[model samples]
Target: MSDALSEASDLSGDDSQDVMTPTELIAKLEEAWLNEKFSPELLKNKSEIVECVMEQLTHMEENLQRVRKGDVKASIHRMEIDRIRFVLSSYLRSRLQKIEKFFPHVLEKEKSRAEGDPSFLSPEEFAFAKEYMANTETYLKAVALRHMPPNLQTIDMLKAVPEPCLDSFVFLRVKERQENILVEPETDEQREYVVDLEEGSQHLMRYRTIAPLVASGAVQLI
Candidate 1:
C-alpha cells in the first residue's frame, strides 16, 4: 500500500504538463474531502493550485502597471486586466464556495437572512456590510495588482502635474447642494464652501494625483 501510494504521488508530481480544467480541480478538491488517506496530499495540491493562480494574477498586475506607466496602451492593458479579473473572479468564487462549505453555519445564516427578510439588515447594517465587502475586495485587488509591472505612463502623468499645486491642495470638506437659479452668490459668506464627492471617487482622484505627489515628496497624506 505504501509503495502504491508513493508511486501515485510520484506520478502526480511528474505530470506537470497535465493542465487541470477548473472542473477537474474542483472535483479533485471534493475527492480530497471524502477520502481520508488522500486528504493531506489533496490539501497540498490545492495550495499548489492557488500558487499557480497567484502567478497568473501577478502577471496580470504587472501588465496593469505597464499600462499605468504608459509602457502599454490603455485599451490593451484594460483588456488584459479585464481578462485577469474574470479568471480571478471565477477562481475566487470557487474558493469562496469551499469556504462556505467549511463554514456552512455562518454562511447559511447570512444567506438565509438575505433571502428570507430582505430588510432584516437595517440601513446602517447594509451600509456597513457593503463598505466591509468593498474594502476586502479592494485589498484583494491591490494584492493581485502588486504582482504586476509598474506602468511607465503613470510617471509621465505624474510629471505633467505641478508639485506645488499637488502639495497645497488639502481635502477639507465635501457637500452636495442642488443648483438653485434663485439663489444669489454670497458676498460675505459666514459658511465655508464644502466640496461634495461620491464615495470611492475621492480615492480615485487621490491615486491619480496624490500618490505621485507623495512619491516625489511634494505632498503628504494627513
Candidate 2:
C-alpha cells in the first residue's frame, strides 16, 4: 500500500508539471493577438508580419507537444486554443471588411478629380487635395494595422491583389493646346473658318505616369 501511494503521488506531480494553467494560457494568447494587431512599426521593420505569427504558432506547437507528452491536460489545452482561435479569426474578418468599405470613397474622389479639368484648380488647391487624399490613406492603413493579425492567410490574400488595384488615386497633368474652329453663316452666300485659341482644352491631358498611394498598414499584394 505504501509503494502504491508513492507511485500515485509521483504521477500526480508529473501531470502538474506538464500542464499549463488556464490563466497563463489565456494571457499568452492575448499577448500574441494584441502584438500582431497593434504593432505596425514592428511588422514593417520585420518585413513580414507572417513571420511574427509563425513564431507565436511555434510557441503554441511547443505547448501542444507538452500536452502530447502527457505533461499538460489535453482537454484544458484544447479548450484554450479553440477560444483564442475563434476570437482572432472573428476579429480579423470584421476588420478586413471595414478596410474594404473605407477605401472606395476616397479612391472615387481621387479618380474624379484626376479626370476633371485641372485648369479650374489653382496649384495651392491641387496641393490641398493631394494632401487630403494622402492623409485619408494613412489613416486607413493605421486602422488596418490595429486590427489585422500578421498571419499567412492574410498575407497571402494581400499579396494576391494587383498593385494598381490597391492604388485608387491618380494625378493627371493637363496641358494647353491650340485648335481651329469653323463658323458657318446662315445665308448660303459664304462660309467662314475661324481659329479659336484657348489656354485650356476640353480634352484632359494625361501622361502614363502612375503614382501609388500606399497606406501605412496596407499590405502589398501581388
Off by over 4 Å in 1: 1-46, 63-74, 101-222
Evaluated at residue 176, the lDDT of candidate 1 is 24
lDDT of 2 by residue, 79-147 (tens): 666776675554343333333433343234435664553332234333544565567556755767447
Q: Rate the local accuracy (lDDT) of all candidates.
A: 0.38, 0.38
- Compose the digit string of candidate 1's lDDT tens values, residues 171-217: 31112222211222245664434333432232122233233333332
Off by over 4 Å in 2: 1-54, 62-72, 105-222
> In terms of TM-score, how similar is model 2 to the real structure?
0.25
In model 1, the Cα lDDT at residue 82 comes to 73
